[model samples]
Target: MTCRLPAALALLILPALPAGAQSLEDSAARLAELLRAGRAVISENQALINDPGLGDKGLTPEAFLSQVTAAFLARTGSPAVSEDLPPFQRALAEAQLEAMGQTIAEAQPLINMEGVGFKGFIPAVFARLANERFGELADGRAAVKITAPPELVRNRKARPDDWERAVIEDRFLSAGWTRGEAYAEETGPGFRMLIPEYYSESCLACHGSPAGETDVTGFPKEGKAAGDLGGAISITLRP
Candidate 1:
């Protein structure tokens, strides 16, 4: 299913900004929305891999994700700036778009490696490799990670980091939020972050089941429901 940000949640997440920074905030919010949209497209398309028509096409999940990203960007007129924005806002928008593109590029290979079958060891091993390569491409300016809570994935990397644990605990675990998107400034200067991810029907194959059952990958299942939070795609930015 396509995910839509609730209006109330959107309003709550918008940062309070000074008049001078309002334009920049708007630009940032727009970029975050785009990132969320891109993720949703990937999720929905990935879920379709099992369809008779789509399955016969023989495209791997990663390849399908890349195709969807390209089509979404093209349809949305991405990399285009509003002419009315001031020079600074225009520049900020352009930079954010570039970073988003680079992040997608780096993520695609990892998703490709995981494939569609949720097979043994491939997902876990390639997920680590993807994170390593993404770290190299991010080059200290930003970081991206895909993780689930300890109860779900049972891997060290699946555990949320200090920056993320509280949010996951409160918003996802406590409140039953299946999907979320947010942007926040870090304690340090010029550092901010955006996170967007959600659960989907296909996630149930591995994550949903008897708690101790072995999945296709021989990993213990989480006994999660269809709408349970599968994991997150978190992107931290230095800009």
Candidate 2:
């Protein structure tokens, strides 16, 4: 299940842009979507991954990617990447996939450890590691990160930067801000994209409940309910 590809073999597949900056926007959104797709796989298999009785959880990076691919296709009606895309965009997708794979590979020991429940390979941690690897693979060409409001940030690295904070405070949190709408801009020499993420029923397991009560992850819950603004996925693409 993938989007229809350009049929003309000789054509370099580039997304049609109504404006000059749309390619970067599209590429950034694609990378973010793929990253979250991987996170969804991890989220879906939390039980199996955390089962102390089950060694070799069978969710190898390759297997995980296959699931992620299917999830992405189902979510967006597009393949994570295609031979039809132009070299740069294709390279970004490949790097993101490789980054996620490497992250899962590195966590084998923790993921497969016997008698260890809740190995801390949660989706947030997985995304952080994967994004770090993607930055290295992109060699400064692009970067992806998960950031949240200052009070809700559990990890310092996941804390919003100056631009990210502004967007979060001024746009995503505003009463008039459209739910699930993404904000993008060409800021300075790079393109920046900020996609708002909402708290889901599953997210409540760790992020919801009585305010200040500790969750399973040992972090105090923010008492966020479903549909609340949980965070955002920020992407940067440099020329």
Top TM-score prediction, candidate number: 2
lDDT of 1 by residue, 130-201 (tens): 444444543444345666665665667656776566666666566545456554555463444435455566
TM-scores, all candidates, are 0.54, 0.90
Clashing pairs in 1: none
Instruction: Locate the minimum summed-lDDT window of 10 residues in model 2.
Output: 5-14
Clashes of each: 0, 0
Cα error, residue 217 of model 1, in Å, equals: 1.4
Which lDDT tens digits does candidate 2 get at residues 87-199? 56776777888888889998998999999998888999999999999888776778899999999999999999999999999999999999999999889857899999999
Alpha carbon lDDT of each predicted model: 0.50, 0.85
Residue clash pairs of candidate 2: none
Best by lDDT: 2
